[model samples]
Target: MVFSCLLFGASALAAPAPWYLWRSKLDGQVFCAQTPPGVGWQRVGGPYRDARCENTGVPGK
Candidate 1:
């Protein structure tokens, strides 16, 4: 049971983290990150399942 639980936990950690697109307020440049990139950046895109900003539930929106 302990081994199974450890395996499950490891799998969960292997999952990709959600990412978001942030636009720089100063330069209008956009970047992707798992969390807000600190001051002067605003969130424009969202909760992407992949690093490339792809794979949202909607198909093409």
Candidate 2:
């Protein structure tokens, strides 16, 4: 029973958080936009001009 509990905890720790991307319209650059479970979308970058946000599955390279 102890081993099973440990295994379950490890599995939960290994889970990856879902992430999205927010792209900049002026410069055509993308930024990390993580929803963070129940939280709303947030822009990772400092600032940009007329920035348009979008939810993308992959991160910027």
- TM per prediction: 0.64, 0.26
- Per-model lDDT: 0.78, 0.47
Error of 2 at 20 (Å): 12
| Tens-place lDDT digits, model 2, residues 4-47 | 99999988766344455555555656555344322333445432
Please, what's the RMSD in Å of model 1? 4.7
For model 2, the superposed segments whose C-alpha errors exceed 4 Å read 17-61
lDDT of model 2 at position 12 = 75
In candidate 1, the residue pairs with backbone N, CA or C atoms under 3 Å apart (3 or more residues apart, or in different chains) clash, namely: none
Supply the global lDDT for candidate 1: 0.78
Q: What's the lDDT for candidate 2?
A: 0.47
Q: lDDT tens digits, residues 1-61, model 1?
A: 9999999998876645688889999999997788888899999988786666776532223
Candidate 2 TM-score over all chains jointly: 0.26
Prediction-by-prediction clash tally: 0, 0
Top-scoring candidate (TM-score): 1
